[model samples]
Target: MTEGRVALITGASSGIGEATALELARRGFTVYGAARRVDRMARLTAHGVHVFEMDVTDDASMTSGVERILHEQGRIDVLVNNAGYGSYGALEDVPLEEARRQFEVNVFGLARLTQLVLPTMRAQGSGRVINVSSIGGKFYEPLGAWYHATKFAVEGLSDSLRLELRPFGIHVVVIEPGTIRTEWGGIAADSAVARSGGTAYARQAKRLAEVYELADRPSVGASPRVVALAIAKAATEARPRIRYAVPFGAKALLALRWLLTDRAFDWAIMRAYGPR
Candidate 1:
């Protein structure tokens, strides 16, 4: 049934979103890559991927994007909620407005878009919702409070949605990626320093920023293609797992999180990014 299925991927301008769009399109799906950065996706069209501007934080853009897909394709088989960012800063240092923006981009926009697509999916009697979470969803880090909160919310929301959609033949799957080579790390590192440096958390924020930069390096982070492959598998599988933690390390990291006592894990995270 996934053959020739229509797929819409958010945040397709760069990184994993872009990679997923390419992978899905290469697999013969009618792929629509959506992002506010319309120009960046111009090359995707060469591969037969439809490109459009979509600001996930905006309601009109999301609604109209879904409408366009339904109008053009008559059905939306896969929805990839991949548009998100890491807003890193000490909880006390990050402005409430920024925190709210994080949730708006990472959680509420995803929820609303799913709401818009469910009616069509129900009519078709089949669909897939693939949410791009992170290993951060399963663990903690310094200066990542707002970002982690949004990802944690995604984890919980996707889990509950999977149960609710099963009867309707709609499979909801979560993809938790480990550190991936992307602009995200640089952006997050900058945010951490900008928001927390010179404050009481400056020392820890600097260390967190270093970690982000280190992980962003191609040598350290896995390629976004790895996550894209995992997503394609989830989208096409007859019975995808509840979650796909990519590149092996993500699953092992999540397992360790569950295995260790919270306090012990906290110590570990501190030793890695915060003070011992």
Candidate 2:
């Protein structure tokens, strides 16, 4: 069943998306890597992965990408909604426009792609929708308010979809990854610094920026491959779990969040990020 199956992954140019594309290709799936940077995905072609340019915020792009896949492959077995970025800054420091843009890519774009792909998957009577969320969905961090809000939305959306789509044999799975060695930190830190340049929260935001920079290094974080493995498993496993929490600590954090008092958990998170 794995062989000849088609998988379309957004944000596939790098990070977990790129890793997942490679892993699925290795498992004999016809993989399509979609991102804004088409050139970056060119290397994926060497491993039998097709690369497509996609801007999740564009309606035409999302529609055309799904259409092309259906025309070429006739059926799409999996859809990985992985195209997203982090907009990190304190709530007041982040501009409304930037926050909306963040939701456009992280939330609306994901929803659009899912809408575009659902009919085909339903027609086939079987499919999988894997959403690459983050640990921020369950927990919070300083300067990550908007980013965490988007992921929390993803968590809620995926959960609701899972129940609604069960009758159609369409499985919705969420991959919640902890900090991984990726360009994500650099992007988030840059955003934080940019938004904090003349803001009151500049000092605390910069400190959080340092944390992001330090947390994303290879020594402190797990490899993108680790999250990729989880995505692949969610795609191919029989009766896949509704949620796959990766990098080990994710589930523990979720557990602690549920068991600990709200004040205690807030204290712990703040302690980990250092004094505000």
Local distance difference test, candidate 1 = 0.92
Q: Please provide the root mean square deviation of candidate 2 (C-alpha atoms, Å).
A: 1.2
Worst 10 residues of 1 by lDDT: 267-276
User: What is the lDDT for 262 in model 2?
Assistant: 83
Q: Write the per-residue lDDT of candidate 1 for residues 1-276, one digit (tens) a residue.
A: 556799999999999999999999888899999999998987788889999999999999999999999999999999999999998888998889999999999999999999999999999999999999999888988888889999999999999999999999999999999989998999998999998888998998788888878886667799999999999999898988888898877878888899999999988888888742
Q: What is the C-alpha lDDT of each candidate?
A: 0.92, 0.91
Q: In model 2, which runs have C-alpha deviations exceeding 4 angstroms?
A: none
Candidate 2 per-residue lDDT, tens place, 1-276, comes to 699999999999999999999999999999999999999977799999999899999999989999999889999999999999998888988889999999999999999999999999999999999999988898888788999999999999999999999999999999999878899988998888888746887876778887887877677888999999999999999989888888887778888988999889989988877535
- If scored against the real structure, what TM-score would every candidate get? 0.98, 0.97
lDDT at position 58, candidate 2:
93
Question: Cα deviation of 219 in candidate 2 (Å)?
Answer: 2.7
- Report the number of clashing residue pairs per model: 0, 0
